[model samples]
Target: MAKRPGLGRGLDALLSSAGKKQEGEEAERDLKQVPIEQIRRGKYQPRIHIRPEALQELADSIRAQGLVQPVVLRPVDDGYELIAGERRWRAAQMAGLHEIPAVIRDIPDQAAAAMALIENIQREDLNAMEEAQAIHRLIEEFGLTHQQAAEAVGRSRTAVSNLLRLLDLEEAVKAMVDEGQLEMGHARALLALKGEQQVEAARQVVKKALSVRQTEALVKRLQAGADKPGKKPAAARNPDVLRLEEDLSERIGAPVRIDYDRRGKGRLVIEYNSLDELDGILERIR
Candidate 1:
């Protein structure tokens, strides 16, 4: 079998070994021409939409150059269930293809979902909301963790966590993210706000078409004004902040203070017990 263009190394390795049977069966990923009507949508498919323009462009390509890659499938009772290449299947249908080439596999349900998620994620086809929901499915529906899912999809744990954070947005706010009216940064900044303030802030963000930096500023300004008098500020416990302090303290061989308000107004104070420690800290910073 040939490696498809634009397919990442991780997914390439996965698909290359996808259909070889475990112990019970000797089934291989033998390419077969399957009737389009017999193929059903993947049970674990998280991708909800393939843009019409993109599909049409794909269809045109399929018409002119033929489907360069065969869709992957697993056998069902009467037909095959799609494992990957749903976009190709949809585009082939658009190109008026009655039957398409496929490779039949006999993998289990969890593997099916993992492949689907990995493919979409690697291809960058899913929108932010869809991607986050898919990652959530990997953790919740498919019994993987943020760490495991991160490893599976070739992303950092922090990246997966950030993506998952988009799900915490209000339904309407999430919808805006889905439609690309708001980006992940915008959505993330909004997470700091809550209730009607959150909703109204989202509205203003959309109305003003604010940049992410501007959105963050808006959140900060709102938070500053919203604080009541005599309310004790919560200590900043951002992991990044703590991590930085730890790193600096280790370098300087002294205690480090990362002083910041809840509003992120602050300074870094490195406490050196000796002149040698102070010189070391300054050298490290340099």
Candidate 2:
């Protein structure tokens, strides 16, 4: 029948596609009041945590006004599987509704997953960690490239990359993010550290309730103090010199070292990874 819309065409196209009847498909595209017990949660559903209070609030709303939007579902062995609107489904169950309105369609696993990710992202329902994990699954399970994943979610490649980087965080730190104690920005800042330092820094961020900017500064200061093997302790260096080194390194996009003798005679060394980087640094200096 008609070609299924590409993931790059975005959520609207996908949702619209779900509404259209495809040739040779047994299911018709229409809203049906499906029994709550017959519709099970989808394997592709990306959301992990549903706040009790929020679900209660939604349940109250559904009780007062009814479900404004129908959840999308795909046919399965004995029951239908949720394709999107899991929040609505959960809230309906909580509201003690025997049946919920849903749009039944027959779609593949990948489309169902992409639709779920797009719906949650568009609704701003997922926390940073959940969103990251969803995006990551889109890549790993579907073999979509970074750019393709970004397009599927209607986000920039850099945004997708940043979210994926959150997955690199220590599990404890990721929990903090998932729990909303730390924001995405704070998590990204924490990525600058590794090992125990990252864990401790995450604790400090939550305990102190540090803002994103403050967390970034803390990461910089921590990096300055972190002593590596074969290197002098940065704590011994003048704090002013350390700050200068960090500032220069940030501005030049390279590692910078500042060494000063007691008489104030010293050198500012900028490290580069490549000849092109060296040329860029020289250009900046000029």
Most accurate candidate by TM-score: 2
> In model 1, where is the ten-residue run with the lowest total lDDT?
1-10
User: For residues 1-286, could you state the per-residue lDDT of candidate 1 as single tens digits?
Assistant: 1223332344334444554454345445557899999999998888886789999999999988888899988889988999889899999999999999998778777668778878778677788899998888776754554556777788865567668767878888988889888988888778877777777888889999999867866875677664446666543357787678767655644446587887989998754333433444465567
| lDDT digits (tens) for residues 52-82 of candidate 2 | 9999999999999999999999899999999
Clashing pairs in 2: none
Candidates in order, TM-scores: namely 0.72, 0.73
Residue 225, model 2: lDDT of 65
TM-score of model 1 (CA atoms):
0.72
Which regions of candidate 1 deviate over 4 angstroms?
1-28, 226-286
